[model samples]
Target chain A: DQQVKQNSPSLSVQEGRISILNCDYTNSMFDYFLWYKKYPAEGPTFLISISSIKDKNEDGRFTVFLNKSAKHLSLHIVPSQPGDSAVYFCAASNGNAGKSTFGDGTTLTVKP
Target chain B: GAGVSQSPSNKVTEKGKDVELRCDPISGHTALYWYRQSLGQGLEFLIYFQGNSAPDKSGLPSDRFSAERTGGSVSTLTIQRTQQEDSAVYLCASSPQPYTANTGELFFGEGSRLTVL
Candidate 1:
């Protein structure tokens, strides 16, 4: 019962290029989604999030697109940098606090 | 601590031994959660606690697994007679607001890696 899924295990892109990460969920009840970036031996840092009511959310070079009807969302980083290389996780949750379900994670590597 | 803190970053225990992992959430946060993850695997929900409410332990794998939150701040996860399969990273997270249906974000710890030999 994997409610959230990130099919792509790894992604590679060149510096200053666009990096897109995809995520899908099976439970329509989920109304909030978030993305987190994790580095080796460190906690996952909060990146960005979107509510089901909105279709898109952006912050600086990071943007999150949500397609509620399709139960899918994606994170886009424009002009990706080497510092952006890390394991990105997509998590979803319903009304339950502290009960978010997480995807396996996508490892993104930016080549300089 | 400025963020969630988990102790015993790495632990190696023999099979059948018990182990305890600790987590200290942010000072003012109200919601705390525990999750397990294997290498290259997704986070697995283990338990959830909010304020003084009863914890949600539906995700716990078995009776051998138990956890408790004390003084509404620190949490301890104890595994009795740990099995080889019990080896995994234990992560703890906290949220300022109780994540309702509309919004919420989690602040996670680095996670405690457990190895059962």
Candidate 2:
């Protein structure tokens, strides 16, 4: 059973546009949510994250919104660039444990 | 090697052979994790270690898979009597204690790819 789910297999966006990636989880105990970006032959790279207590967190061009009631979270990259093209994975974890469950990734391609 | 480091970037072994994967986590990080990724798949948790507490091996696929974290710094994962299904990229990640804060950002290695023939 997949506790975390990224329904969309891929996303495409134009340059300088807003690229949004969505994820959902079935576990209510998960207190931490994170987003990772990966390129070919490389491990995932941390992008952004949000806590259960907060609704929104932003860093530079990237932002993450969490809606606990809906058990959904999204990553938004404003003014998407071609370099932003990659596979994005969402992960959730309980606050105390060392393990984080990951969802099937969404491949994002930002066209220049 | 400021970030997590993994050895044997690529390995090809025949079936029924044993293989060892090593990971060197970032200095001073208290938590380490192992994950597997098959082609076109997401990260699969294999194991993790928190300080001196017993390592969480709940994600191991079977008894053939085992991992050990020595001195809370480096970790090794061993797969015995490996099968063709065990071939995948094994990744290592690390984080500071209280990982929830700071977005729980995990530093990951390039990963070790294993192929069973």
Candidate 3:
């Protein structure tokens, strides 16, 4: 079963616009959420994360909003740049210091 | 310090063969993990290793798949009697602290792409 899900397979947006990516989870035990960006043939880089205690977290141009009641989260990129084009993956940890469940990932394309 | 590093970026082998994939986690990091990603699919949890604790192998698909972490540093994932369905990119990651800390972020390697014919 897919514990985490990213419904959108791909997204396209113009440069300098705001890009929003969404994710959902089925497990309530997950207390931490993270987002990672990956380029072709490269490992995913840590982008930002949010704790279950907090509803939102922001780093530079990236912002993550968490809604516990809905079991959903979102990542927003402001002033999206061409270099921001990559696959974004959402992952969750159940506070066990063990395995993490990852979403299918959303491919973002920024058109300059 | 350098990030996680995985070797043999690409591998192609015939069915029934065995293959070994390697990963070197960041120095001093105590937590390590392995995952697999098939084309157009989500990442699949495979195994996890923490300092001195029993490694979690529950995510492993079958007995043919086994992994070992040597000296609490490097890790090797061995797949025996490989099948074509095994073709996918294998990824490794490490965190400075155990996942329970809730503050550590997972640093990933570029991943090794395996192709089984």
Candidate 4:
């Protein structure tokens, strides 16, 4: 069973537009959620994260919203740029264990 | 290297052969993890190592898959009698904190792509 799921396989948006990616998890034990951005031929890098205690966390142009009631979370990027064109993976862990379950990832293409 | 380092960025082997992939995490980092990504699939957890504590192997897919971290530094993932389905990009990551209040962000290495022919 996939504990974490990202239903959208790919998303496209024009530069300067908002890009939103969604994720869902079935494991209620998960208390920490993270977003990673990956470029072609490279490993994933940490983007942003939020704890269960909070519903929203923002950094620069990236923001993450967590909805514990629905077991859902989302990553929103404002004024998406071409540099943001890459695969984004959503991950979650129960606590400080550091073993995170990841989503299938969504490829975002920002058109110029 | 300043970040996690993985050897043999690409590897090709015949089915039934054993393969070993190595990872060197950032110095002083106590938490290490292994994950694999197959074509059109998500990153699948494999195993985890934290400090001198016992490693977490619950995510190993089969007995043929095993990993070890020696001296709480370098780690090696071994696959015995590999199968074609085992082909994927193996990713290694390390974190500075594993037991305290932290951001839970992982620094990852450029995965090693394994192809079982």
The candidate that wins on DockQ is: 4
Candidate 3's DockQ is: 0.64
How well is each residue in B1-117 modelled by candidate 4, as lDDT tens digits?
A: 699999889999999999999999999999999999999888888998999999989889999999999999999999999999999999999988773355678899999999999
| Candidate 4 CAPRI category | medium
Error of 2 at A55 (Å): 1.0
Error of 2 at A95 (Å): 2.1
What tens digits encode model 1's per-residue C-alpha lDDT throughout B1-117? 598999999999999999999999999888899999888888889999999999999999999999999999999999999999999999999887777333467889999999999
Residue range B12-112, candidate 2, lDDT tens digits: 99999999999999999998999999888889999889899998888999999999999989899999999999999999999888364666888899999
Q: Residue A81 lDDT in model 1?
A: 100
Clash pairs, model 2 backbone: none
Please, what is the TM-score per model? Answer: 0.95, 0.96, 0.96, 0.97
Choose 1 or 3, whichever is better by DockQ.
Answer: 1
Clashing pairs in 3: none
Name the top lDDT candidate. Answer: 4
Measured over the true interface residues after superposition, the C-alpha RMSD of each candidate is 1.9, 1.8, 2.0, 1.8
DockQ of prediction 1: 0.68
Best by TM-score: 4
Off by over 4 Å in 1: B100-103
Pairs of residues at least 3 apart in sequence or in different chains that clash in candidate 1: none
Better of 1 and 4 by TM-score: 4
Between candidates 2 and 4, the lDDT winner = 4
The residue-by-residue lDDT of candidate 2 on A1-112, one tens digit each, is: 8899999999999999999999999999999898999999898999888889899999999999999999999999998999999999999999643478999999999999
- Runs in model 2 deviating more than 4 A are B98-100
Measured as a fraction from 0 to 1, the native contacts recovered by model 3 come to 0.63
